[model samples]
Target chain A: MRRENTRIFEKETTGSFMNKEFIAINALLTVEQAILYLRENVRDKRNIYYVYIINEHDRLIGALSIRELLSKDSNRLVSEVKVSKIIFFKTDIDQEEAVKVFRDTDLVSIPVVNENGKLIGVVHVEDILDVMQQEATEDFHRMAPVSQKLDGGLIESTIGALYRKRIVWLIILVFINVFSGAGIAHFQDVIEANIALVFFLPLLVDSGGNAGSQSSTLVIRAMATGDIHLKDWFRMFTKEVVLSMAMGFTMALAVSAVGLMRGGVTIAIVVSITMVCIVVVGSLVGMSLPFIFRRLKLDPATASAPLITSICDITGVLIYFGIANKLLNL
Target chain B: MRRENTRIFEKETTGSFMNKEFIAINALLTVEQAILYLRENVRDKRNIYYVYIINEHDRLIGALSIRELLSKDSNRLVSEVKVSKIIFFKTDIDQEEAVKVFRDTDLVSIPVVNENGKLIGVVHVEDILDVMQQEATEDFHRMAPVSQKLDGGLIESTIGALYRKRIVWLIILVFINVFSGAGIAHFQDVIEANIALVFFLPLLVDSGGNAGSQSSTLVIRAMATGDIHLKDWFRMFTKEVVLSMAMGFTMALAVSAVGLMRGGVTIAIVVSITMVCIVVVGSLVGMSLPFIFRRLKLDPATASAPLITSICDITGVLIYFGIANKLLNL
Candidate 1:
């Protein structure tokens, strides 16, 4: 059905997938009469789960399931038997927002109305399951920062297409990482004085990126699912301060042991202090990127692991060497 | 309702969320009489969408939607009216598998049966939205390699809890990255000869990790969504070879430009060669870990960005230094 669409509703809107074969009964029809009307019209409708009630203007005024109508008085008009408090979507509602409606109302189908409240179509739960899956897949792909939408399966995508999608981010990131190289070059004296500092370079920088990746992934995913919101940043920041400090302290203890074994007390202290500071910095940087993205009206999911890692690498290099320079007096 | 469970269905099985208040009718009864039976009993039932048909032995036989019954012959026996080819789940079926069933069938609800084929309960599509969201969240957290599941919202989790979750992966990764440090230490002779080599180290190594991360994340997400199965690995591997070579060549070009400006033609040639080799190796490592994890019956999602980055960092260090040793001739 989707392949037949010229546009593929890639806007991911409720209107794009709305079923126009919906059967809306006259509000004046009795339960028996509505059954007769539905029996004649709803034979091949995919969204046969419910019969909506529309008034003179064809506005969706109420809705009731056929199962619920079964227990109602047959002579009573559907207007009297229907659930008057209608939960519905406008034609332009985002698929994700529509999904939230389904989650909150527990309704199998919803009427899609125009802004004027006239029923134009219906959205069924059947299509919504696919929508949720597709939305989640997009988030996963975007968080990878792969420009290709994975419209088809990965195996089906051509090598050129895959390369095109992947190279964009890798190129951008590689250039972004030049700053980390510059950061290293800027602190060349510190590195030259104690060449042993290079041993913990990958270990320390990767730790910062790793810690950042964890926070960014959590925050981006939480935002996607509506679990966390923009307003919660202050509270989340406070929470992260304690979390990163604890993480930083534990990481410092662990790395200092490696520091002591490899380069004695001076190197041990430098790496340990760097570890604590960088972890705290990396985590906060990771936790904050999504919020910054959201504020800038970019997708929070694009605060991806690679992007955060590149940014953190620069910071980690500067911090690691700065601490070493002061401690070792290079 | 989930909170009331002494167990929160942490196993995430279908039985954990099934609605036991389902209505079933005697197959011997006429459709008219069955309707009367349902109208009396289904008023308070949560699984009101479908009424199942049970035989004399209480074995599951057929099921029909009340909406479908509205169009059926009133006096027809339910055995004759019902659709006998019923879709159902056994008590122990996983929730993820159940979600697949819903996606495929487009049914609002499905019956759950015991081993002997007695209808014990029903699972509704309403509950499935939450299940998919939860499953997706778990995949997100585990890919972050956070051990603590985001049981409540992230903002709601204690600092201690968040710290514990974030620290486990960070600690493991730091130890795993010891190989990278060891790899650099072993190459001390190569680095001591050309101090300029240290400048491009982070940029080049992170490119490999960044590229590799893209591949691993795509594979892991595709596996989770049933987009690609384990059997497709060879086909995907062939595709990846071409894809990675293209990406490797592009990244080499991008970085060699930096290599040329920073350290003349000789450094450029070494960095460019290292870039191509490391990117290819990293991508393969990233793509292969998920398949290996799946083969071991572990979650492929654990082939997270950070885990793959750490492993690739070790490989990248070795590849970078090994190439520099031969080319620079220290």
Candidate 2:
């Protein structure tokens, strides 16, 4: 078996191997060779459709259908009946590009080739679909701000299997939160003096998280769709910064109104001002973090919405309190 | 012009109209005709070397080529000369299923038919790609725990535009925070009685938000990939609950260690128990919200990660303070 494997690999490399394994008999092969292969080696030909044909260089040349073979003289050259022109992928192409090619071709299987144009492997459409599903799952996980791995299972099993995958990031975040917590703790005196300021803490943190999620989602989606690229990072950040400001200003107005309705004018103004600043910071962080991750050659999805929000939670609180202390003298 | 427009609309209803919007001379006329009138048009044509032939009833009967059209007798009947045995898509099929069909067929385009065998639309590979991107983006956003609009601009004229999108959600959260703030403010006496409790508040909230973000990201991702369906909601809930318990218990131990180093046994126990319960609740809420949104026929991606964390933030604080008030007797 080892010797045979070596022989097969050698044959494949030299591009002279003329066996069923090297031939791709089920997709665009010559009619004569396909029939000969079927009669001699293929025990089950019920589902087979087309036989693939390759050249001396291992480049795909054409295809021959089973029906075509049955209609032709058995002795006829396979080349005479084979349909020319085949769709395939170059090996170095991006996976997403491969998916697009598959979608465009609508082929059940496409041949993949190396840089030298030698056929290396076949990428089945089924596999592309699998990749698509996996990618979609990853994007979802990234949005959740969870540490991503391929295997997605039940929470119980996955927690065990993906403990490090999930917790490593969370622990990092936890440590980061310590700084945020410390910042808040450092402002304990302010809280003690103006206890009402503590009333808006959740509101400020929540708002910043929400804003961050929105900006990050748009950026991530844009990147995934080819609607935006890493080169567009600065553009995206600029856009989010403006959009967040307008949104923040409007939100501040609304919060101020709510604050006035609930508390006095002082509380309303403090809450409103803090909200605008927190949101602006959140949007900036959310918009830029994905780009930063991308720049670091990381998956942009890694800077997930939830993770961004968590980060914003720390910053939002710090900003809100800092602004409140300066503005309200708390 | 009005008369022509009326004629066009009438012709469309009767399936007698051929769209003259663009003349693709290289395309198989029959396929092009189907796309011209169909709501969904074929987006690519690089697969299946030859385009299949169809009859007026839209029944697949043969295949033809650009070469044949250019070389064969122009007067030859397309039906008489076209190669037969065409592949296609059954209408009413799932879009994702259609993607699978396209992948398998290796055709540039597939004809879509309804139950009555009438061609309704064409699902182009490009459209599938768009759907894949959109679906992935939505998942990315949902994992973030905040909802975002489906349509938004990626470019910004000024920082204000960027700020506005983020600020809206932040402000909404700020108002929501009022309730949390009120909760914290209402419990001021608790903080005043035990100042150290205030020190742990930020840590507790941050931990809870982090845990919830982690779980929500996983559940949202699983659902996005069609791995976990609505039918699996119970399983998902059960899994999350158990996982959260374990996570909560582990976190309690860790926090307890910190508490012991900082304070005494009473503070350690209080903080530890509060951390465990809050983290567990946060995970449950975070994991469940996306599923709820999906059930409501809303995009689960709209359940942004930040939103979940914010919700967790408020809930985490509530749980912490509520438990602390009861246990510490402030």
| TM-score, B chain alone, candidates in order | 0.95, 0.69
Q: What is the DockQ of each candidate?
A: 0.72, 0.27
Model 2 stretches astray by more than 4 angstroms: A1-97, A100-110, A148-152, A155-159, A162-165, A261-263, B1-111, B119-126, B143-153, B156-171, B261-264, B290-304
What lDDT tens digits, residue by residue, belong to model 2 across residues B118-233? 44434444455545655555445444333453455455334544343334455556656666776787788876776667667767887787787677667666665455777877
Docking class of 1: medium
Q: List the candidates' TM-scores in order.
A: 0.96, 0.73
TM-score for the A-chain in each candidate structure: 0.95, 0.75
Can you list the residue pairs that collide in candidate 1? Answer: none
lDDT of each: 0.85, 0.61
Model 2, chain B only, scores a TM-score of: 0.69
Q: Please, what are the lDDT tens digits per residue for candidate 2 over residues A142-237?
A: 544556465546544654765556666656665666666677777877767767776677677777777776777777777766667778877676
Task: Point out the worst 10-residue segment of candidate 1 chain A by lDDT.
Answer: A1-10
What local lDDT score does residue B51 receive in model 2, on the 0 to 100 scale? 40
